[model samples]
Target chain A: MENTITSIFDMNIKPEYLFIHLDAVDNMDAIKQMAVNLAKQGVVKNSFIPAVLERERIFSTGLQFDETGIAIPHTDTQHINSSAISIAILKKPVTFQAMGMPDSKVNVEIIFMLAIKTAHGHIKFLQTLMNQLQNKVILHNLINSTSKKLLINNFKSLFNKEN
Target chain B: MKKILVACGAGVCTSTAVLNKLKSILDDRGFKGKYELSQCKVAEVPAKSSGYDLCIATTTVSEVKCPFIMGIPFLTGRGLDDVIKKILKELEK
Candidate 1:
């Protein structure tokens, strides 16, 4: 064995996991597409799609940011082979029911699909990412980045020293 | 210690993030040993909420029997101060 280990901050988001200017009619379609991509990449099992969609139907994931709207759709640990995050920047915003407010809706432009293998593991990484989401400059950079290389670099840069 | 319930969609991802953030805030305010944290799925909140002093969740929950707080502030860091204030007031009561 190589005996290599990875930290959540150091986890590499493969270029294949990044999708930009994607088109989806609604949150379900967007999530389905992202889950399909993750499955094809061998990041998640084929069951990830229905599990995630069902989770979202009961518990809304939409977050309306000061600059743009976003959603973090995720499910429990059973179907994941490893931990990975899939990024999808929609071509046009889709309506997603707001988190903690099922009746409310948000026009979400970005999606962070989380495939976590442990219930409590990698929480620090999520917190760090959430804090970065608060910064409009970073979200703007992510939204406008043209290539997968740039997008992955932008995400990694969020964990840089200054944070 | 008072029981504090923190739940999300599947009890996996965001709930833990929010729980960690909430713990740090409570620690800073001298709340150590003043409360105990429990993590659960949103679907379990209705049956379990009654035993907890307060419930904080990232997803919409129905039929919660205890006082509830919206956990989005902890995630986004927006209006966090107000959320903290509300938490403090609730804890005090």
Candidate 2:
């Protein structure tokens, strides 16, 4: 079994998990709902929800770049049956109890749901993730990207550079 | 001089993003001072922000006080200017 979460670029669209909408609830909840919907699709497993919640409870996974906050949700390996990721873009901002600064709230705009199958994968996956976060140019292109294929390609280029 | 401490889940990824933006903004805006950049887990954040003028987190952290700003926007420079202004305004005091 592969012990790492696939990079956003390596992930193929499940089609069912891909959703674009103007969320009505608190933006945070809207993003969580996206994970839940994906869970129900048998994309991962039922345990994924609590795992996500647990991770959230431990610390906020809000990806802060610029004033834009991207909420990326993931759980321990024990919680997942498969490895996948979901991305949800909110039409408006919602207040979230941000990490590090509980007193400050995060006005979340983009949320990426990460589903990991194992803890070992977690480390490797995060390593790539961290590298990607360093380059604002790539990040800008990612946020500016519209099509999923473009998104994936942009991400894969990182690995290509590793060769 | 504004004292800022920026941290992310691993300290390198998100926190670095936060620091780069801040350095750019502060430089462009002509503000300078001592700043600290490091990576840490959420559990360590509470005890970490001390003697620091401001705290920047890309993940959830609590049990610490001072001005806390999330680095989410800094990742893409999406809604960063206003937030940088907000933090700078407070630190300028």
Candidate 3:
């Protein structure tokens, strides 16, 4: 049981999943670009694209922090093969409907596309990510990271601190 | 004990994040062990919300039997204090 719990918390962000300064015209474009990469890597099923797009339309994941705005776009577990997070730092900000507020819009700069395999499996990781998001320094580091290695290192450091 | 229901699009990502933040806030505010939290998809809110003292969702939900709170601030880190105040007010009642 201890091993199971440890392995669950061992979720890693793959180096290949990190895209620096990704170019996209809109929110859907941004999501599609990242979703396609995950699909190519066999991280998620082909159905993930449509499922995530449809889900975003109804329940947006766009979050606007004080200085930076980010979005966590994800779909159901059925669309995932393995649990992974795809990070895309867009070349320019794209407009996304704010979560729980369809009338409001957020200009998102970073996108964290989550491909989760279970409902409650990554609670700790998600919590840690939320805490990191609240940190202006970390969010600044993430947004200004120009290299994939730097971004992945910054991300890995979060989990490292947790364990 | 106060019963809290938290829902997102798929009961996975955002809800889990919000639930974690809510737990820590409530725990700090002297609510530890005094409440229970359950996660579900937003579609289930109408049916599951009746039994909960508060329904917090990352998206808009309709026809919730309990008082509803928009949990986006927990994610964005904006207006979170106000949301926490609202939650404490609801749960304290």
Per-residue CA lDDT of candidate 1, range A86-136, in tens?
899899999999888878898999999999987887877888888888999
Candidate 1 lDDT over B26-85, as tens digits, reads 999999999899999989999999999999998878999999998988887778899999
lDDT string for model 3 (A60-120, tens) is: 8888888878899999999999898889999999999988898988899999999999878
Winner on TM-score (1 vs 3): 3
Interface RMSD of each: 1.1, 6.7, 0.9
**Distance (Å) between predicted and true CA of A92, model 1?**
1.6
DockQ of each: 0.78, 0.15, 0.80
Q: Which ranges of candidate 2 are over 4 A from the true structure? A: A1-16, A21-24, B1-93
lDDT of 2: 0.61
lDDT: worst 10-residue window of model 3 chain B: B72-81
Candidate 2: how close is chain B to the reference, as a TM-score?
Answer: 0.83
**What are the TM values for chain B, all candidates?**
0.97, 0.83, 0.98
Which of candidates 2 and 3 is the stronger one according to TM-score?
3
* Model 2 residue A102 distance off true place after TM-score fit, in angstroms: 1.0
| Top candidate, metric DockQ | 3
Tens digit of lDDT per residue, candidate 3, span B21-40? 89989999899999999999
The better-scoring model by TM-score among 1 and 2 is 1
